[model samples]
Target chain A: MKLKGYRRPDGRIGIRNHVLVLPCSLCASETARFTASLVDGAVYIPNQGGCAMVKKDLEITLEVLSGLAANPNVYGTVIIGNNCEGVQASLLAEKIREKTNKPLETVVIREAGGTIKAVELASRYAAQMSREAGMLEKEAFDISELILGTECGGSDPTSGLAANPVLGKVSDKLVELGATVILSETSELVGTEEVLAPRCKDEATKEKLLRIIRENEAHFERAGESLRFGNPSPGNKEGGLTTLEEKSLGCIHKAGESTIMDVYGYGEMIHSKGLVVMDTPGQDIASIAAMVAGGAQLVIFTTGRGTPTGNGIVPVIKITGNAETAQLMADNIDFDASSAITEGRDMEELAEGLFELAVQTVNGQKTKAESLGFNDMSLARECNFC
Target chain B: MYGCVKLHEKDTVATAILPITSGEEVHYRFGGQELTVKACTDVPVYHKLALVDLKKGDVVTKYGQKIGYALQDIPKGAHVHTHNLYSTMPKEASTQEE
Candidate 1:
């Protein structure tokens, strides 16, 4: 299927044309946020890790920051950093430049004199980039040019029974259409390696997928905890989810029935098309952030208990399968997929409508999350060994 | 419309889509067969209704797999939440127990 999107100079397709004001570390975050506030059409994200992070965490932080800027959804970027931070603004711009030829500018908080002066300098560039971004025209692009991210949060039994399965159908359809669809949440997928690994396209991909899930289990074991004994948050329990296996079985539904193409590390760029897996924490915002940084232009978040989380720089479509949560949190929920279980609606018909809504979203239709201006985000870290 | 929905034929429980009152008859369809069970108590919307008489320590199945074990003997069509069912599995999805 064809969808209308903005074609970046690097040939990537973006469903939204946003000028990003990125903060490389926490020190420059307020400056970046203020700068973004000074300009319309320019968005900023909070950064909590520009300095004093452990080596591995710093690397992840840098990758996530640069990747968010290089995401196809961003038309251009204005990077800001505290000069003392390890993630320098110029260095970050360079990283982004290596990924895309989009317009880029950098400002160092200290060198720009202070936060106020930095905000002024950064906003000037952001305003210019926003104006330039507005001048771009939407072009029709093939579905293969899209990277769709899938996630499930605040899950209950309805999520596993209906909502996720519905998203899985759409993921399968999108994969069949030759588009990229990501199945994330490695922590949640711990006990399902047998079920998921066999779907991998090749043995190498299977091995990679196995390693990530095993490593996650090992990580928890090291922390003297058990993922198997302590999952399905209280909200999930209240919503009828009884075990981690039950939750994982339902969470994987969003990947649909597509074969796994490959596996990627946290926030790494997803190059393989069709169905792929990403190594990310089960934390809602962190998982969404990893995929968005890895190039997912749009996100479909299925929540059974209900959540109003909107990932920064990506349009998140909030879907729920609980009839009461749908009506109770009507303003936050974009779609009520409860009929799948409530009335036993035809699965294909339900999925077709969701896919069409995705198409409309790709064409610039505002999701309830976007309309609410929610910008939830978080970066994953290996440890606090700094 | 059925008061509850069963996803798998083997599931020992069915999820209630609407609030079910005590002593109400809960009807659901499983593999083209309609079945009925009298609610033993009030079941909240989105909660599980016991599809079978479950004894304490009996593994309750949903989506055709063990979701949890009965904390106490649960009569057919009783509200099944944390009150009478709890997970005793070796692994879980959340970070820690609350």
Candidate 2:
């Protein structure tokens, strides 16, 4: 299927055209936010990393920061940084340039003499970029040009039985149409490794998937904790999930029954098509951010208890299977899969409806989260900052 | 519409689509046949109900996969949750009982 989208200079298709005002470190976040607020079509993320970070942490922060700027949705970027931060504004801009040839401007807080001067300088740059972004014409692109990310949170029994399976059908159909789909949240895939490993396209891919699961589990062990304790979170238990295995079983269904083509580290760029897995923590917003950084233009999030999580750059389509939650949280939820259980709705039919909605969303249909301006962003940290 | 739904034929439990009171008739389609069972206990909406008599230590199956094990003898149609079911996976350090 074809959808109208903004074609980037780097040959990627984006559903939204945004000029981003991004901060390279915490010290410059307020300036970036103020700049974005001054421009009509600019978005900003208040990044908490960029200074005094360990090697591993610094690498992750830089990847996500640059990736967000390079995302197809962003028309250009105005990077703000604290002059003495470990991650410099000029270097960060250079890193982003390697990913996209979009317009870029940088402002160092200290060099600009203070927050007010930095904000004023950056805001002017952002305003000009926003006007440029607005002038770009939308072009038609096929579904193959899309990268869809799947995530689940606030899960309940209905999530597995209906919402997730419906997502699975949608995921399968997307892959069948030659589009890329990412299945993330490694912690949720713990007990279902056996169900997923065999779907890997090769021995190396299969081993990689297994190793990530092992490492995730080991991470918890090293902290004197158990994966089962935190998973099936209180809300999940109240919603009828009893164990991590049960949660994982339901969680993997969102991957659909497609062959696993590749596995990626958190925030890593997705180079291959078909269904891929990203090793991400089960935290909802963090996982979505990682996928969006990896270049996903849209995210289909399934929630049983309900959430209004949306990214600054990507549209998050919230799906729910609990009829009550769907009605009560109607303003937050986008699609209701609860009918699958309430009315015994055909899974295929529901999936077709979902696919059509996803197409419409890409064509500029505002999701509830988007309409409410729920631009939540978070980065996964491997260790404490130095 | 059925009051409870069975996700798979091999599942030993079904989830309540709505709150089911004691002795309430819950119907589900199994193997292409619609069957009825009397609720032996109050089954809250989205909660699980035993599809058959479950003995203590018996594996509780849902979605045709092992979810947990029955902690006590559970009659058919009885509610199944943390009180009567325990996860096979190790418990969290904080929530572990002495």
Candidate 3:
């Protein structure tokens, strides 16, 4: 597919050229937001975990924050921090710099002396970065530069039967074209270890995939909890999903039939090509956030019940296979694969059309999530929100 | 025309593509062969229709994997769902009772 994108100095390509106003912690979010508000092309995300986090949570939080700045979708970042947070602005800036040579500037609210002063200083940096961002001419890029993230939410029978299978075909096609595809949602992929393990290219990769799935399950087991309790969520039940197995059986179909190349920790930068897995929570927002941090420039989300999840830095294209949902949630859904069920349409033909849509999305076509101005994001934590 | 879809050749149940009423003859593709069965009960869209009779305790299969276990005798063409089947996996501490 012919496309135009920003080739980052780190040798990654971005479909979107966004100047990011990053808050290292929640205390600096307002400052970052106001800074972004002044710059027409700048964007900011709500940073809820930058301060006073427990050990593991703090580590995951830093990975996510730095990963966001490192994401290919972002052209540059202006980091803002409250002076005494668990994650310091200087440290976060240093972390991001370790990942890329993108334009970066930092401001500490306390050092600036107040919110107003912080906003003023950061806005100047963001404005300059946004201006510099606009100066780069679009150069030709292709699918090989894409690290496509796949997800499913509010799923039902048709997701397993139609939508996800259709997406599987797309995943295979993208992998065949030499692009990287990330499959996540570790909590929901329980029984599929046997299904996914043999497909791994090496024993180390298979072990990583197995260990991640086991650890995700152990997290709940140690809490005196069961994945089945809230999973096949009430919405899932109403949508006809019965058990975690049933839901997972439907979920893994998104990965298609590709050899698993590598397994990544949540929000860890991806270096492997072709099919890989990211250890993310089943929560769609958090899962998408991890993939974005891992450098996914775009996400293709399949849903049987339809969802409006989006990210500030990435475009989430929603697809569904329920004809009724396709019409009822037409405002949210980007592609409808219901024809695969109702008419038993050709899966390959449907996948080709979806790929064409993905190519268009890369070349600047806005998805339903993007058009709706949705910027929802959440981080997967090992402990309490603190 | 298929009224239901059997995802894998070994699946004992097929998912209804459209709502089906009792006494309706449902046609579905099993493997490469088109098979027909009478719906003994109504099947909601996206719900399962039994392609073969199930005695109590029989394991329910979909995508050729064990999905759950039957709670009661399920005749061919009957709607299969939570009411007549139960998940074998662990449930929440308090909601373990059926």
Q: What TM-scores does chain A show, candidate by candidate in order?
A: 0.95, 0.95, 0.95
User: What would the TM-scores of all predictions be?
Assistant: 0.84, 0.86, 0.87
For candidate 2, give the DockQ. Answer: 0.38
What's the DockQ of model 3? 0.31
Could you tell me how far off, in angstroms, the CA of residue A329 lies in candidate 2 after the best superposition? Answer: 2.0
Winner by DockQ? 2
Which residue pairs of candidate 1 clash? A25-A50, A227-B92, A228-B91, A228-B92, A229-B91, A231-B93, A231-B94
**What stretches of model 2 exceed 4 Å from their correct place?**
A228-244, A384-386, B8-13, B18-25, B29-98
Chain B TM-score of candidate number 1: 0.88
CAPRI tier of model 3: acceptable
RMSD of each: 4.8, 3.9, 3.8
- Clash total of candidate 3: 0
In model 3, what lDDT does residue A146 have?
88
lDDT of 2 by residue, A1-386 (tens): 88899998888989999898999998888888889999998999978778888878778888888889888888999999989887888888888987888889999988898999989899999999988888899999999989999999998778888899889989999999999999999887776765678789999999999899888888877777666556767877777766666778788888787899999988887888899999888888889888988999999999999998888899999999989999999999999998779876666778899999999999999999999987898888885210
Candidate 1 off by > 4 Å? A229-244, A384-386, B6-98
DockQ of each: 0.29, 0.38, 0.31
Q: Which candidate is the best by TM-score?
A: 3
Of candidate 1 chain A, the 10-residue stretch with the lowest lDDT total is A227-236
